[model samples]
Target: MKTYYKDFLIRDWQPGDRNPAAETISTVLAEYSIIFEPRGADIDVLEIETYYQETGGEFWVIEQEGKVVGTSGYYPVKRGEKSVEIRKMYLLPDVRGNGLGRYLLKELENAIANRGFQEIWIETASVLKEAVNLYERSGYQPTTGIETKRCDRIYIKKI
Candidate 1:
């Protein structure tokens, strides 16, 4: 509901938080899938856990009064490009429209840019108008390349 920015206390997601994060992700995915299918709709919990376990990717959680309201993460891409694919960006329903989404987007961009990534890419269903707008406003423009089987808007921002 309420939103504000503080120092982003982020680190690699631990094994203990994997299930909770997966639970949270499942809820969001189910909720959103009603309108637009997520890119990786067939992903299993074990696969999700393994991604966190193996990639050593950054999974950031936003805390307000010590409660996790939102999360964002990135995974490495192929060589030469040296890109990071932003994934699993979700904010609770009650936390929407209060500026937290924009805040989180900025945090992710800053984190990725600092890690020496050349650009960031994201895929979301076109039905998610808010997400498309957020990406555009955050300097991401529509891109030609999208690898999803489903129809999803693709956006990229140069770091």
Candidate 2:
């Protein structure tokens, strides 16, 4: 599926997108002073589609002039689960505040809802105030009981 937002094209991630997607994510992390630890197992941007597909999920990339600028995806919380978790939602600083994040989120929500998901969850760090604000503005409420050393905030929205 392909979606057009101005000059950007959003579509399901292709095999060739791995490198660019990874680079985009790495760049954002570095900008935020977030360390990339291979042992943490969270830097799997290169295999987004492969990882999400096992659970009937999907990864999408937004590109401009054939270059990846943003990415997001959703996967089931667990096997046969009705709840899904949003992952790898990131965009370059240059593209921020242009409504592209909201667009990407809406598309992910639609895809999750179509797959019969009842709720959507996202984990983020408090350092990312913009993302937290976006989630709050989008009707996601804070939730407890999830503890992660790296990610301190958790939000949930029922669809």
Candidate 3:
């Protein structure tokens, strides 16, 4: 599915999107002093179909000027009943502070809920203050469990 937001376009991962999407995510992480672990935590960004689609999930990319600048995706997890964990949500420096992050998140929630998911979980680092605030403002409650080495906070929202 494709969604349009002003001059930006939100769409599913395509054949050539993997590298650019991974670079966008890596660049965003670097801005926060977080290392991008492509073969480790970020392997999904490299193998979208294997890790996301094969597990009954999806990965999306945001594009502007025909170039990818942001990425977000989710996959099924065993933490909660019919739950999916939101992962790899990163916005490039160019797209920051334009309300695009919130828009993408809302779209993710709607899509996940439409898929009959009962709960949505997010794991992120406190260094990303904007992300933490976004989750709180979006009604995601604080929770325990830091599965990723770079992440220190987890939040859950029931749909």
Candidate 4:
């Protein structure tokens, strides 16, 4: 992992990061009884390059002393003209409430804006209360047409 996202030791994802990132997402979702669907909505976690980087998108891994504690990324989508969908942003339970999620979302927006994207979209389940609050507080307006089965809410923010 290469450090480039401020002072938090956040960096782009790598193939070696697959397992730890998956574990972090799984652990976070399991807290709310959400299943980690490797073959469905989460397949992008396992194929970061294909779903993200390969299509003008990017993925990042949050590191704590060389351990993957979180994951964040976005992929270009067909909505809002020059829009991208924010996906796979999950942090270990211990890392919550420390402003990491807010920071990550900000940095992700910066990265997205720097890439010349116009808007950012997100789909999340209601059970992830923290995530739902983060998105709403960060100026992501709730929208319709949720594409993910597990996600009951859809939000969009113009960058």
Per lDDT, the best of the predicted structures is 3
Q: What tens digits encode model 1's per-residue C-alpha lDDT throughout 10-105? A: 344555555555666666666767422323542523355555435645666555555555567776766327688787777667667877778778
lDDT of 1 at 65: 57
Q: Give the clash count for each candidate.
A: 0, 0, 0, 0
Alpha carbon deviation, residue 60, candidate 1 (Å): 1.9
Query: Scored by Cα lDDT, where does model 4 land?
Result: 0.88
Candidate 2: deviation at residue 1, Å?
Answer: 2.2
| Model 2, residue 69: C-alpha shift (Å) | 0.5
**Global Cα RMSD, each model:** 4.3, 1.9, 0.7, 1.7
* Deviation in Å, model 2, residue 28 alpha carbon: 0.5
Q: Give candidate 1's TM-score.
A: 0.77
Please give, for residues 28-57, the per-residue lDDT of candidate 2 as tens digits: 878889875544545456566557877788
Off by over 4 Å in 1: 1-12, 34-53, 64-67
- Residue-level lDDT for 95 in candidate 3: 85
Q: Write the number of the candidate with greater TM-score, choosing between 2 and 3.
A: 3
lDDT of 3: 0.92
Q: Which number leads on TM-score?
A: 3
Clashing pairs in model 2?
none
User: How much lDDT does candidate 2 score?
Assistant: 0.83
* Residue pairs with backbone atoms closer than 3 Å in model 4 (clashes): none
